[model samples]
Target: MTLHAHLTRTVARPLPITSVVIDDAFWSPRIEQGRTTTLPTQEHQLRTGGQFEALSLSWKPGDDNEPHIFWESDIAKWIEAASYSLAKRPDAELDASVDEAITLLAGAQQPDGYLNVYFTVVRPGERFTDLRDGHELYCAGHLMEAAAAHHGATGKTSLLTIARQYADLLIEQFAPGGPLEGGYDGHQEIELGLMRLAEATGDGRYRALARKMLEDRGTEPFYFEAEEQRRGTPGYFGFLFPDRAKLAERFREYNQSHAPVREQRDAVGHSVRAMYMYSAMADLAPQLDDDSMQAALAELWSSTTERKMYLTGGIGADPSIEGFAGDFDLPLHGAYAETCAAIGLVFWARRMAANTGEGRYIDVLERALFNGVLAGASAEGTHYFYGNPMLSRGDMTRNAWFGVACCPPNFARLVQSLETYAYAQTDDSAVINLYVSGAATFDFDGHALGLSVQSNYPWSGQVDVTVNTAPTVEKEIALRVPGWAQDVALRVAGEDHQVQVHEGYVRVRRTWRAGDVITLTFAIVPRITRARPEVDAAAGRVALERGPLVYCLEGVDNAGDVAQLSIGDGAALRDEWDDDLQAVRVSVDGTRHLNTSSSLYSSAKDSVEDATITAVPYYQWGNRGKSTMEIWIREDESASF
Candidate 1:
């Protein structure tokens, strides 16, 4: 596994953010809103919350809002998101603000390149003592990612210089035979961040360090357990749980250290941690050409998306650990599908798509992008939901901020970097992974190839691709045919081509000319979807799906609580445009069960009446004020009283 091995696995490269321009009716405005509204609002929150000030190392003991172990990562994610937004749409005020934060961070760095405010300012000598709860490496990973993003966006290496210094320190202290040998972060993030750093710096050492960390994880004599024993205390958050015996097991599994990374096939532990770790594994497997690692990732992906995932593409069911429950234990109302977890799933999905060149990964990516991840932020972009629940009891609503704010910045960065996920390219070919309306430039054998896409995706299934400029040499263009589409019709310059699908992509190879047009039409009609019988919660229920969007019934659209509504399996559904939402709404023939007896545990069945149920996109549910929302509706029965 050397740099040569990494180069050999290159299949397709995501077009740089600067090379693609998004002019979408659905996504353009949201990206702009994230830039103007979300980033600014989040910056204010970070500043007011003392995160920015804490970067200055000014916090003293007993001070208000004492710097927490994870605060740096929050601000680092914000900086990364702000950098992406700045890359697309520059704001002088925002740029200056980022510069100021970088200055503070640079000033806070220790002489040895260590840079964590909590350890440096609050607890000076306890730097690497408690890796399980310190979050030191996790914060370093985020800073490294932020530095890479900032350097790419502005071409300024000030942040990168600081990040690399810290990374070098980490490698020296944590690598084999080093002082912190056999130790890794309690949280699984630095591995992914090291990969990014390697790309940013064009340095193989970072990649080597990442590989070492991954290989070292899940080996005999767990690092976390050893580190915990060295501390000789329960570590932080130990007092929260009463049972000491169960607490040890919970702690080990919660951080994903129960088994070795390669042998750990099931998607266990904290959902976000598992996603990040699996994402790093997927990324390195191809680079290192490790077959066993790839196999483990595939099994973990199935365990996650197939058995543990919700209809909305949301993972993690238990709120207690803010992570996963057992298999098929998904509860619609009690779901703790954190927005960051969904974003991590998207990260893993994109890497998997690149690794295997498969469209199935894109299907799950699109599902989470439209529902689980998009539901995190409000339409205005100021408020956010930390946990996205499929069934809300009229109480869950977006808030301005949280004490431990992670999702807002995570959501901001993902949407800002949406263009990179839309398409990937190599020297002689390109792959369209998403259907967002955008224009992109790619290299075709040293010649510039220009392409523009036009589509009303998620709302409609028609897409038209035009080649503005092409090379004389023949090149291949691969368009992903979504797994959910019943059939896809393809045409090139008014000529219908045989729909020859390979590995879930329709690859068209030819010498392109200017003004050449390619058209794709998919059967994106509303359809009923049912879960597996193993899913006890949704065994007798069905959900609605149109294209990649999952539809949910909201109380505001339905006039009241939607808990009692039931749609028949054979009921007819119509798609109608709504003025309020400005999106397609699904109307279905349903029956509402009214409890006439009104007694607790009554033997008498409830009476039912005909109803016209209105459903909106799951992503657009909580926008119309607080309302009851439900995704899985009970199947209508013939014997209703």
Candidate 2:
């Protein structure tokens, strides 16, 4: 496809963040932090963690490798973050550091094109022997993703060459009829990463490669079962893996291959892996036009989102497997919504949007963004939360860092790469997927289409879009009217314009000219949301939400534990901008219900006392000192949340 055609492809594609400039109060500072603070800090962590040192030593052949099992992928994620940071705003030192790592990786590549520091330096003779538990393909997937990011941002092929070589090696081992037969990644990441590689290089074979991998899993004589049998039971296995029975059991529900991807309906196994595999399926659905794959994705998405998802748009209620347990079996304090799961949810949601071009997908994306992903990182952008919970009584808090530091880099990379998800362009139209103060310019049939947007967004409901295109370029611009918004007001150049609202977007079509403007206002008001009665954890409770954000009550703000609070039937909610939280805080008239018996199990009903309190955005909680936080408040009525 020519540049013009590709730029205006009807199918949804992310505009290069480089082409679009984002300078909003909401996102610019976060991106800057990723560039200046987060990237540098993560790079330092990777170096101190001996990720680069391990790869460099693996290349030395005789040296011992002293890094963790998944260090390569951790470093790869940091590299991915650095690549996005560099693209958004270049950093000389960070670029040099990434170059140095890439050079080390280039040297570490085996003559056979294999690249893994753990297998090479630690278990040289046993490469590809532990696909059930090993993360070799997972690391390769992260490297491919990093290479794609580096190539897209810097227009350099050095890293891409390394990734291609590694990919070829993976194909040689795992591809159909390859020497190493029936091999698949224990982790489901490589499939999605392969899709990214295909998009980066425009080689459909990578997509084919991804499809082959997904189709191969959960087949007769499952690779995971065979691997487990080959390794034998606990006492019979090798000393390196002292617990084979436990490891063997992990291959079942923990890896998400208990059944074929298409046959699986409910989300199972690792939350991150489930989302990754499903996202790859969704990404491949439109590309291959596969009906089964599409149906599988739709059913899986509905299964996860409808009954299993949290009010905060989180999944994986069970911590034992770090994944889903059963439908509507959500636990409040024991919620195990990992940061990686939320990131994978964002990935899935975006691909789903691109596949269908529907606002519902973006709605899920925004929920994960404003609540889960945003909550992963701290207000300073340095600390991270690996697990996000809906109701915490001071036990959960963001850590400075982690031994397995996936969330920090993942959060950093996502925040730095926000340009793509903000807006998208079609062949003869464009979609405003997100509301932010920024500008996006793309070519539409030999015409330069520029969209300049200004809005306070989640802070306020008003959004103003200005068009800078030739009058001859007739096109449509669809503004997303959030599902939460009703009676949306629209205007064109100061004149009230009547437009039909469909699905979730307000469509306006006309010949565009320079300085043409469109304004949209969504009514921003606080709403009380309740969960289904089946959610026992949230029975007779409610959550507060304003705009796209979900609000929670923290103990510090209310001067008491949130468990003591209850919302009246006709509560009057008020909004005020809290400088500390950096968001508009909502206060509600409520009651503090307490049992006077002082017994563990009291037969008497709790006494209700008048108490007014404020609630902050769920993402803003824990920013202050450690305190109890609760999402679901006791309802005066019988509404569950």
Candidate 3:
């Protein structure tokens, strides 16, 4: 069973959580926290934030509060997270709460199968009137995802029934000749969700709807243009269309629809919307055998990774559009690397990996997973930053919650389903994706299989795998040697052996025994990573990375003025233990630049002395209270100070 109902994944199938067990010290506790603390806290935030009351059918005509159009998606995500939790760890009370929410949400559905809380409770007559700003379909897509998750978690179809009714109603309303024809949700989610529903319940109608939604976009007598004409468009991108000269041309750029999806290349528009659409395209292309669609995804991957992405795997170069600006337009401090967008990147990358039998997809996935996605939440597992910036000046801090708090729950759901991303299985091979200590047992070609893994990753590069209860046939195990790893060594049965190393993984093909062990090690040395010169904001700056962890200097440890410091050289870095954070600290030789200029602008001077400062992992910052924080530093290009 795959996390997504991706029956068409060409290269590999992601074994469900039931097929694997996570027994590691690192992920076990993290998953437990998500189950106990994060899920409950999100529920409380939703309840206190008036989500239940907002969606309730008991609202009077004179109710003062108008529901947020997108409020239902938040509840949908919460139920999805809770459903994932209930699948692994059963809880009677939590189960009851989820069922209760499902019942109330169902009660709010309109007679026509349209299930939007805002239109039902707030504006009854104007349902689906403003599709661009309404978010009716967006909310439905998330609820459909929740329905699929609930079915997987509880093995029940109560929520799935609601989603089916919603899907049928949507199909009736938006079919080729229906009233909503030639229209798509301004947000790109329903396409992915429809595909999930089609897989969950073997109905081709949903997939048909999914394809129609994508196909109907960017055609002549444009729906966006017509909708903008009727609504007098005022939105940032999708809303105001006819207001432009070349209407169809510019809307495609904003919607990643310049041409048909298969023809579009560079990543564009709202970062999250574009990513969600791209992920669905990747999932559908192989099933339809559409090579052009796959080619578009490949082109997009190169454009985003090689130029637009940050060293920390963050995206979104422009804060105004909450999307990309141009090639190599990465800004350090002013960057709006939305957490949801980065998580969306993981979805796209994983699908890309499954489509193409390559390990470079895993490289991009691991980098984003370790840095950008992990940096969304604080250490306490509660506070979150909606937008993650590479540089923070003693002011950027996480909030308990936000008005549009999509990122928090979006991340919570991702953390709950970590098992699916850990490994992918094929007929004769099982790929080790992420190095969290876990024991996975699954059936391969009608034969029983068992494998156990141990690692102290990021902090240490050594990984040990034991072929416990081996397969009857020769099963090849491909271990991902991360792109960052250089000097990697592989050993079998305590004896050094050379293996066929491809793209970015070392493949060991052998028939194994229960006691047979394989050992692998990668040098865990701190190295400096520099930004491309085109990124003017980070021209002379460099960041430090060891293994998968990106290091950052906080003001509290560096005399409260982190900007005054410059990195001397990566070779001078040394590791030390930090009792406060309960993690390793890396310190490097540097110099504190003297602020000798009387005016704000002056000639650069080298009045400095030798100094050093400590740095913590990017994920560990803002825990000791807010202070100046920076990932990139002034690189000592000439010599060690």
How badly does each model clash, as a count of residue pairs? 1, 1, 0
Candidate 2, residues 1-641, lDDT tens digits: the string is 11111111226776778868897988888889788888888887777767877876534445444555677788888888889878867778999999998998998889888888878877676677777667888888899999999999889999999988888777667666776666678778888778788789886666677778887777777776677666563211235566644665454667777777778777778899888888888877765544787788888889888888887888899997789868898888899999899888999998888777788988988998989888888888878898899888886778877887878888887888898888877787778899978898877767777889999878999999998654375788888888899668999977998767786788888887889899999888899898888899998888999999999999988977888998877687899887766789999888887888978997899877778878999988888878999998988874222
Off-target runs (Cα >4 Å) in candidate 1 are: 1-7, 242-249, 639-641
Backbone clash tally for model 1?
1
RMSD of each: 1.8, 3.7, 3.0
- TM accuracy, model 3: 0.94
**List of clashing residue pairs for candidate 3:** none
Give the TM-score of each candidate.
Answer: 0.97, 0.94, 0.94
* Candidate 2 Cα lDDT to native: 0.81
Sequence-dependent TM-score of model 2: 0.94
- In candidate 2, residue 446 scores what lDDT? 74
Model 3: per-residue Cα lDDT over 449-473, one tens digit each: 6889899776788889988788778
State how far residue 270 of model 1 sits from its true place (Å): 0.1
- 344: Cα error in model 2, Å: 0.5
Question: Which segments of model 3 are wrong by more than 4 Å?
Answer: 1-9, 60-62, 230-251, 569-571, 603-606
The alpha-carbon lDDT assigned to residue 478 of candidate 1 equals 89
For candidate 1, the 10 contiguous residues with the lowest summed lDDT are 1-10
Each prediction's whole-model lDDT (CA):
0.87, 0.81, 0.81
Give the range of the ten consecutive residues with the poorest summed lDDT in model 2.
1-10
